[model samples]
Target chain A: MRIVLVPGVPALLPSYASIEDPVADLRAACHHAVAELGPRVRVLASSPLGERVARHLLGAAGAEESEADPTGALVVANGSAKRTVKAPGHLDERAEAFDDDLRRALVQPLPAGLAGIDVDLAAELWADVGAMPALAELLTPGTTAEVDYDDAPYGVQYWVIRWS
Target chain B: MLELGRHTFADDATLMMAIVNRTPDSFYDKGATWAEDAAFERVAAVVEQGAEIVDIGGIKAAPGEEIGPAEEKARVVDFVARVREAYPDLAISVDTWRAEVGDAVCAAGADLLNDAWGGADPDLVDVAAAHGAAIVCTHTGGVTPRTRPFRIEYDDVVAAAIADTVAYAERALAAGVARESIVIDPAHDFGKHTFHSLELTRRLGEMVDTGWPVLVSLSNKDFVGEALGLPVGERLTGTLATTAICAWAGARIYRVHEVVETRQVVDMVATIAGRRPPQRAIRGLQ
Candidate 1:
């Protein structure tokens, strides 16, 4: 039962302009997740800096940009810490599309050998996590469980997906 | 080969009957009327996605497109023969109400009959009964939308639909078709509106209660599109959602276009529901 955690990060944040180093914050979050999940962890990300941060933490050896290997784990994190923000009007659809795009970009890149992938949702966006179970069922199709990450200001929602 | 009455399916995986339109005016795949190789490629891709059955049809049972019985038989036979040769063990189901087409395809090694008319033609029933072929009885009032309105007046839609299917089953049985030779499909978008389709899906437990396997054909249907506001090409997510719900409701068969994706959805739902064992161990791991 190898586990992978993929956390969704809200990139559009009020703090993005003020923060001196977003990369440092992302690296800290990755370290926090690895330390919590233990030493045996592999993280998947779309951002080059995030991938670099993950490689530094997970000993980036033979890490490829594909999800063909099913032995590793995936963890996705959304960057926003505290905000119940709803996209205005049809922007909800765009949010959904963004969420979907992010999910596909992360999961599709995973190696098929990874046993299961888990998603960590932004705590502030819990209300926006509707129909995630169905989406997880479609994309991952294994043992799925939602976890609460209370460390972040907004409690993050985590979906743990085991391989079918 | 696993025998369903006289019909034989070589694969053990659940069959996915891809909708092949012979009519030149189908709502989604209308231009597919003359693309035999493309149709065959679709079948191959579906098979790669774990579909064990392929259903071929000549007439578009939609609003205004209807082909004659002779043309229907010719088209179906030609397609089935070509598919059978390409994939010998593939279970080919002929979608037609005419007996001649059913008879011709069954002779061409086609394994099943998917009749939307529910054995309305005696010759079709006779052909199925004579050959021991598996028959999928779907509820379509008639070929034309005018004859079969989108909204049907029934005392209890679920009960009436089940009863109608049972009655069709009885007729097929009386016509010498074996009991196991028949499967029931609620006919999700054929003359039924979105509400009706959802009602049928919600009450799918009742259909499974009939002591027969149920084939759910909600893949890329109009009701799904209406519910999710997605077009046919973009409806994969919604279609997978419906497939998951139906599998949860205990539908043994699913007729879908996205075979690999649908198979994964059904497998996951089945695993979660405990209907089947998990592919990997979930307990006693160190």
Candidate 2:
């Protein structure tokens, strides 16, 4: 039941506006979910910078540095979100370009055993709402483990990989 | 969608009919028996297990011991009335070839007339037509000898079975029975050997091709017993296997003993065939 939320490109603006610091918001969500759900909770943030920020937040939460290993990490990104905000006039071409960029981002090299990547902001937003843990379980080396998304109202596409 | 009594058969799924024999010498459950309470329990159990129809037979119809029309009608009428009273929504089918029994059962709330004699008795067809109830015409040809002597004579078994069943269908239709209300059964294990049953099942798709649903009753029959060398009690697995094969070959209705298990197997087969998988909810973030 551990959940990791990755902010969609569109929701990132509102998220940063509320928290003023995107990294701090991600870390607080993870720590809160873990404290609420007990020790089983492990929240992960997507992106190399996001991962570094998550580790720092864990230390600030009074969690031992040794207890917070690289194994619990997730990289979240939204491929479709880029297409949503692309130039409205040339929608099809811009959407295609956005998709290519998202695919490039997904296929890029990352730390070994990274947990699943979240492709949308809604999943990441769930962490702030105390719904899911910040860290996501890795289904495969580069795949996100299946999570209970029945409560998710609209379809949000996301991906995850194993935490190195 | 076609409606039989309160039950509906729209899409092609194996409609299960549990056998309920009131006679003392039924082929499968001869020694193990029922009267009033037992019959009621069996009816409830089968219906709970997803049986759309419960076929009750008064006469043994095993090999010998054929009762007169009056006796058969009396037994059928009384049994159908009791069952109908117990399960008002149940689709009760009286298994008899006597026209008198058909009439009595219809009047007593039976929804379908199951003629094992293949409508040989014109009066039976007339009764079914008069009541506007569905008819299950099974191929039970020739006289039932003392022990059912083996007979293997036919230019083409599949063609002959189809032609004979089609002829019966025509007769029932001509007798005023609606075409949709008629269901044809190849009558496995009734005056037919194992090979005959096998051939009938193999060509069962032809029955479906006739533009009507086919009901194949291979539940714990002699063929399955002989094939698996198991007793009647142990033939459920084999019967389920044959039911699966027949379903793949396009038999729409299955008369089975283990209704729930048979339903699962048929559902799995249907799933693999991509007809419809188990219901699942798709989830994602808004």
Candidate 3:
């Protein structure tokens, strides 16, 4: 099954659109990765807002929500939002190490590492990872990961990754 | 879409019509650009400042020396040709009330005829149509050209303005001007007192509701100056405040001296009114 992961950056939502997009590169990567997740896909998101973002991206890619005999799964998750002082959650001394570990696990397709993420630390760092544990059950031994986007723009670590 | 001769703009687009006076005693600039080169420099500067149209005028609105048709043509015709040769895409509007000068400037590649005196010349619309140029139909309450308001009174200024300008627009349409090419203006302080101008500004939406694009010439005019009791040079703040109100009310064209400042105020107000998107908003969304 095809699987793609996109960031739950609020700027990606249409409600927050600007004339000159602030997250243009990130949005392009998200759209590119999401488009590969064929029609009639299920979305896994940590929060309602994350689900909304996933649906918006899916709708934009001409994909619809489905569960029966689904083509692929779209996961809305992101890294620490407190990587800098100007971040939404402000600077956290432990954020960089946390996002670094998350990045390594995502790019390496390490299901065990993703399953071992400390929920307490994730919450404290304002990271959305509640739905990520399901990724452990989906990633097989032969699965490969490709990072489409990786950045800490606006002090928020965002990644667009595809695993097949 | 607004078809201004060689250029076309979106219906929702807000335009800045920069005032470029060829006269020696225009009120705002005080003869600063009376010379041809100086006026041309003004055109280049306003264009760089992002003005979409330039309203070129040979005679000041206030009463002055009797500038006959020949003198008016001499002041604006060659200058219009010069600007037309330079900025091929710029919308050049000749601010004249004489049909003869309108013909001359339109022949010289002028795009719009800004009839600031409220259609004083009966044949001006014909000239605009013959040249395939747009026309700005202003409401002056029947006052003659070059005369200031002395004791003019209107029972309902906004209603009067809507009636006059819309009728003039229809007249232009009858005279073969395109429906999209005709624009209406509430000539502030043209034939009305300070109170009349203020009421027009406050209720400009009535004119906008006429289904015609509204052009407001409130840039440092006597009405704005009198509203804040400030002089011409100090009325930018008052003018911007009025401009914001008008923009919120959906006025399409702003005729002004300070193009940059007026454009900023209009854009900011349009954004606030949900007519335009924020240029690059990421503050809390990020």
* lDDT per model vs. reference: 0.61, 0.61, 0.93
- Candidates, ranked, TM-score: 3, 2, 1
User: What is the alpha-carbon lDDT for the whole of candidate 3?
Assistant: 0.93
Q: Which candidate has the top score in TM-score?
A: 3
Each candidate: RMSD: 16.7, 16.6, 0.9
- Worst ten in a row by lDDT for model 1 chain B: B277-286
Q: Pick the candidate with the highest lDDT.
A: 3
TM-score, candidate 1, chain B alone: 0.90
CAPRI-style grade of the A/B interface in model 2? incorrect
What TM-score, computed on C-alpha atoms, does each candidate reach?
Answer: 0.60, 0.64, 0.99
- What lDDT tens digits, residue by residue, belong to model 3 across residues B1-286? 9999989999999999999999999999999999999999999999999999999999999998999999999999999999999999899999999999999999999999999999899999999999999999999999888888888888899999999999999999999999999999998899999999999988998999999999999999888888889998999999999999999999999999999999999999999988888999988776
Better of 1 and 2 by DockQ: 2
lDDT value, residue A119 of candidate 3: 93
Candidate 1 yields a Cα-based lDDT of 0.61
Name model 2 segments beyond 4 Å from true.
A1-164, B5-7, B143-149, B281-286
Distance from true position, residue B244, model 2, in Å? 0.5
lDDT of 1 by residue, A37-102 (tens): 334444555555445444554553333333444344544444222222322121222333334443
The per-residue C-alpha lDDT of model 1 at residue B65 equals 48
Tens digits of per-residue lDDT, candidate 2, B194-249, equal 87888887777887788767888898988899888998788888898888888887
What fraction of the reference structure's interface contacts does model 2 contain? 0.06
